[model samples]
Target: MAEHTIHFGILGCASIARRNSRAIKLAPNCSISALGSRSLERAKKFAKENEYPAYVKLYGSYEEVLDDPNVDVVYVPLPTSLHVKWAVLAAQKKKHVLLEKPVALNLKDLDVILEACEANGVQYMDGTMWMHHPRTPKMREFLSDSHQFGKLKAIHSVFSYNAGEDFLKNDIRVQPDLDALGALGDSGWYCIRAILWATDYEMPKTVTALREPEFNEAGVILSCGASLSWEDGKLATFYCSFLTNLSMDISALGTKGNLRVHDFVVPYQDHVGRFYVTSDLGWAGIPEGADPPPTVHSIETDLPHEAHMVAEFSKLVENIKSNGGAPETKWASISRKTQIVVDAVIASIAKGFEPIEIN
Candidate 1:
């Protein structure tokens, strides 16, 4: 390894690169050293606008950036369909990768990414930032071992936002050939990831889906509903939509009580209120508001940062430096499973909501 900071390179000038570029500049051990794009003018323009260091090279072609001997890691923010190709090339170039989410369109592409990373002795991590947010683990901790929620019987979750006619009017998210998994792949993946994380369920035994026609062009499922099971009797339901205004909600039902998280998706603003439950005295709030029993403990915490991407990126770099690999098995496994469930759901919808086994 080089003695100076881990010299980084960016593969595209997408909006996401703008966000991660901030973190790259701030982190002590990382620096964006190169910018690559299909267009030379665009590459130079992005580099100039971002004010990357003077020595940071700009390249007309992605290959030029990867071919550069000094670039150590490549941050890929390409469209979902393009992720696998560049990721494989990055790995083949012996560069570490922080790939954008949906990791790839399907399992085959994901496998290629994994193989490329392994072959080149480089590390790879999907940019599914929400999975690494401290808020999620905190939420899980609060729910565990609690009579307030008894034993969780079922979980229902929803995450959606109207991308509006503007996106459909121009963006590839609405293009049929490009919109393989539909909005579900783009935004709904989180809803699936969060629910599976909270319940710690194995791959859903079966998946069914419902999606609107407009999503055919969006490269995502505009709206979807899926049901999943863990063991013999545990069941869960999840939904995601792009046709409606934004929402982030989750409800965990229990034998004795339930827990609901309002605006749980983005975690950008300060959220109050307790994890409410039905109690002996009637309904009561716990955590940030209302009164609670001595036996019922409440937790008050905030999901800081306007975005969780930086936090996860920081953790990813630190973990690789210290532990020589990605996060624990449960975390990595959940990421793969997240993609798996989305794939199954899309397949089901293609077959008219026919149930598909996850395996």
Candidate 2:
């Protein structure tokens, strides 16, 4: 590996890893140097199918990936339950960690992962792909504009995908042991992160899970919704499921304006993204005609959002390795806030849909 390049070792062969593998390849200073899975044959197959270099190392266990001296970073695409285990181990091994979203089953486990990374002087980041998209900053710019957007009044986010019979019956997301949080952890993670992003990571004063979350026979969530309220009376609501038509949206309403994004979680395409905004929206000519249509803004990116995430993470790793820079805490902070809200939502559901206060 070149001195400036950050070598990445993948810890799982989950379906999401394929997209991440391509992203690693797309990043300028990163390489997918190794892959590890419980089944060596599966690891080998993943390498071949993903078109990784012939020299890429394949190991039979995740620990070996962390043990590799050449690996400067480890990407954990494991299930939520396994995150703290593998992510902490990788951090203890002095390898920077890029973990998949829903950083853990709860905030306590997320803290364990964060502490390990901090103690080991390794960078930590969650794999929230949309956060690295160029469109995000543009949207934030509009939301922060006092004259155009005024004060935020409400936020509504929804993310869902209709899982077919095979997925509903066999997917790990609906399994009790593999992904216990189910749709809440898988789909709702994005919704919560979107809400947090729009609100600049402010913690809501209380969170209440909507009544009657749909669950499978194993008692895993298949669909759910929640409402969050801030101390200043700002409100946000989110819905997530595995039983609806594919949709990813975030609509933020303010006193003077509103913003709408149809593809906030994953864009319609990799190269370009779009969003709409209507500022100072009101009646014109005594309700005879409304103001002009919402302005549509499109952003074009040379690399995919996942690739941008990889590149950003790798840059931090490179800085720490070569320049003796301290690990960036911003990503870890955001992950913690997201997990806190997720835990509150779970608590509310367990308490029979009562609001859970956040401290």
Against the hidden true structure, what lDDT does model 2 obtain? 0.92
Taking all chains together, the TM-score of candidate 2 against the true structure is 0.97
What lDDT does candidate 1 reach at residue 164? 82
Residue-level lDDT tens digits of model 2 in 51-142: 88876899999999999998999999998889888999999999999999768999899999999999999999999999999999999999
Query: What's each prediction's TM-score?
Result: 0.81, 0.97
Best by TM-score: 2
- Candidate that would win on lDDT: 2
Q: Listing every candidate in turn, what is its Cα RMSD in Å to the true structure after a full C-alpha superposition?
A: 4.6, 1.8
Model 1: lDDT to the true structure: 0.68
- Residues 1-359 of candidate 1: C-alpha lDDT, one tens digit per residue: 22235667889888767767766775545677888999999998888787777788899989988999988778888887887889999989878787877677887777778777767767666666655445556556656756645677788888778878877565655555554666677667777877777676556677766544344433445677787776656677777777878877777776766667756655544333234444323433455574554342234434332234444454555566556875333434556778788788767878987888876
